[model samples]
Target: MDPTNGDEKKKRFQEAFERGRDGHVGSYNVWLENHGFDPSRVDRDKVTEFFRENPTKSVNQDDVTDIAEYAGFVTTRQDLHHIPVIGPSGIGKTQLLHTVIGLLSEVDDDIDTKLLEANRLGKKTEDGFLLDEYSRQIAELTTPIVCIDDCGLDKRIRTSLRELRDAVDAGLFVTTWTPERWGVNQDQVRDVFSPAKEVHLRSFTQSETKGTLRVIYDYISQDNFALPSKTEERIHELSDGIPRLIHLLALESLREAYHKELVPGHISATDAAADRLNLSNASARVQDLSEARLTVLKQILQLPDERGVQPGTLVDELHRDKSTISYHLRELNEIGFVERDRKGRRAFYRVTETIEPLVQRRISQEAEYNA
Candidate 1:
């Protein structure tokens, strides 16, 4: 039985207290061990501190410190409020929000929650239908918290953000957005989430990136396959602090090594270079794109490493609509010139390293001609 509910929790705590007070150290130690505590660890206040500090049984201290802190505040705060975790794509924004919700559930089993997806909110018609279904979903929810994962991604959701402000005022809405999109659409953010708390997550640091690489290394090395000396450094440089790219490149490298039938011992730098070369060749396919697609790639190339533009930004930059921008981005993705990452609803499209130099050379030539 779950001891958190009904009389079971009270009985357990009371027994622990009684055992501690009666000088029954042996019994108390057993109780502590049973509860996943160590009696050897000394504390002045005993089990009370343990119960207080560990309100949520699971706490992940590393790899997501910023995420954990924000989640902690949202779950423990007395007043229900809106929280929008803003960051770049592939940084685990959605996963962090869900983790918080799971931890909160441990304390309040009755905490009501629901997840609302923007794109699937309703179907479109020629005359443009109203978001009646969306209104009804928020209105009828018995849950105290309603999570809107991808806030600015869909046109319908972006347009309806103003309407959801009331839900935020009521402290029931949680949303996410990519920093680039959020910056481009500041007006929507200001109007819809005036009082919302925003948490911005940056890219991973070198140590963290190395740690991730170690995990990959350990996995491939289990088969006695050795990696190059500077393999981790090489991958970290190529990935540019983006976690998804790190995993993607690492997997590709492993696959290439296996395909070459290289002797099991040390994976060569040549094998690693082969993986990068393949990426470059795949990106070279962008030359087959039309002028229209090339225009989109040009703008994407100007974006910083591990940074991308949202559909709205692309629309504004290219003077196109959402559908057009999305279409071109998809094409760019298919050709490996641009890679897509999601923060919430916003999909950020950044040019891959394979095509970066080509785009930059074009830009330089254009600059010289204009000058």
Candidate 2:
């Protein structure tokens, strides 16, 4: 094929890709509405009401409100502004961003909101063109809020965020992210975008947890199950003030109570036990423990002379499948629970000191049980 022909084909492919992405956003909006979430636009009053109703769970409500106000103010004064919402995982960062976009839509119906997952966008073959495409989309919108959820997860897209910063500085962009692992200092963060406010959303407070319980109770009220105050307190304690965890615990508790026909009144001891069992099951599923990784760590622990297992020996002992072991090791390393030491060409991994005791306890428990 001729070079010009190839170039034309590539351009067409890029257009198709962007069109598909826009369609996805539209479909997601429809889905949200179908699921009873108001996706049309978030109005200030509606957002305020939501915050008021869901009071205690406002991890960073004040900061979020301030950012939204600033974004609204900037657009009123000028043409555009960029606001980045930053926080750790499960800190309600994504929900807050969506709420802001909803608010923006209320202020201006012409305002268009596009939700993009950075990891998904990063997988595109024509990712290099995304920033330009995003800028064009923003330019065409009467009001635009481009929400890039999980922005810092993809290094390529994050580097490209500088281009977005340029657009924002030029009055054409807005974005958000949960920046738990960005590892950037304040100066670096500030340099990325003008009028960029980094709002740190911490975990829920104890009060917030109790409020979250109230919300959960309201949600499950249709089932005619009313949890006792003591049960609620126990659920809150187990949830550690994490909204998602609280929801999970509450749902599990309700399910258990219903299973035992203990709904609409004081929960029985059996119902509480069932709830505890459900919680344990849910936690185990989410923990993603790697047996092979655990085994390797166990062997290292068992060896009296060696402080750590030889990389090759460890691989041989685990012995299931090379790819599976490699994948588990990569995951463990990424999560900071494990680390590798390189001595020239050879690499050896050891359980991080913090995790060593936990691994030892698990192994010892298994050994005792087996014996």
Candidate 3:
């Protein structure tokens, strides 16, 4: 959530309440759809009453205060250069960036800051030649405080952001997503956005602030439930303060609490939320593995036991060539999907815990399709 003053925070929350009252297709709506729950089935009146009573917290003072102080206010413009907030996927980099935007807006009310969301950066647009027209428009901006979220989404998007990349006053407050576990080339991204104040989001101890907790509960309370402090702490532990995971797991936990349940961790509610989606998606992207790798993984996943299965066995059972199976097997192992154990002469491969849920989901989808 973006931060504001006390009154503004309340106003902002109220606005969200009104906006989501009609069941706007935001995260909550998406979450319901993803979990195969009917959004239309939920009691809107009950949810609305719960939100009005609870009054979800919207102010995150720490986010702005820490970032602004780090940016060095009242000091020289040099002290307040463009800051890049880098972190793993789902670690709330974009949320922090939005908070930074809110904080920076206080400096000048009349002037508007620019924001380029890399995810939404499509090539064509309704406004004519997309890059040419956009580049022209941004180049003319008086206040070039361009805030770009995840410029790494596409290297080509950086080509359109020359003004920010090359300027000081009119520069980028960029949030670069750098999850190395997902096989992202960190150095390549860093070099592209070089000569900026790089703040790698390594420490995630307090990512789930009180404001975040209240914000999440606003959605949960829609189910007519209260978030216990014990359950909250358990969620933080499981999510490791990642916002997406926190939101999903908290809602999943809230669902559990309805049936007199304890806190649901990643493993417990992984089927509920695709927490490892990034890991699986990244493996596919980085390797350009196509469906062949997934085919091999599905086969490996079907195999029984932690004792593991041999490549020769997979070759015989899958009716695929040994070399084809071996190629994907090696790549899958590199992506942490499968673990290989060599018992002196022969090697045995078994599916790792990280990708078990994804494989299971795929298997289920296949079963449903076949039926």
- lDDT of candidate 1 over 69-160, digit per residue (tens): 44455556644455676655555455555655665577567766666665455456554443555555565644356667756555545556
Model 1: what TM-score? 0.52
What is the per-residue lDDT of model 2 for residues 1-371, given as tens digits with 9 covering 90 to 100?
66579888998779878955543245544443443334332122343355434444444367667766766665566655556665434446666766666666666776566766665544444545565676556556544566777655545554556765445433434444433223332245456555455555555677667666665454434333345777666665555444545554554443344446554323463246434533333333334566766665555444322234455565676665667666766776775556777777766677664344344434434544775
Q: For candidate 2, what is the total of clashing residue pairs?
A: 3
Runs in model 1 lying further than 4 Å from the true structure: 1-80, 122-135, 140-143, 167-169, 214-229, 263-371
TM-score of predicted model 2? 0.53
Q: lDDT score, residue 73, model 2?
A: 63
Error of 1 at 116 (Å): 3.2
Q: CA RMSD for every model?
A: 17.5, 15.2, 15.9
lDDT of 3 by residue, 229-311 (tens): 55556555555555545555544443432233323233344333333333324323433546677667666644433467899
How far residue 78's Cα lies from its native spot in candidate 1, in Å, is 5.6
Q: Pick the TM-score winner.
A: 2
Model 2 bad stretches (over 4 Å) = 1-60, 79-82, 125-132, 168-180, 184-190, 223-225, 259-371
TM-scores of the models, in the order given: 0.52, 0.53, 0.51
The CA lDDT at 17 in model 2 is 85
Clashing pairs in 3: 144-170
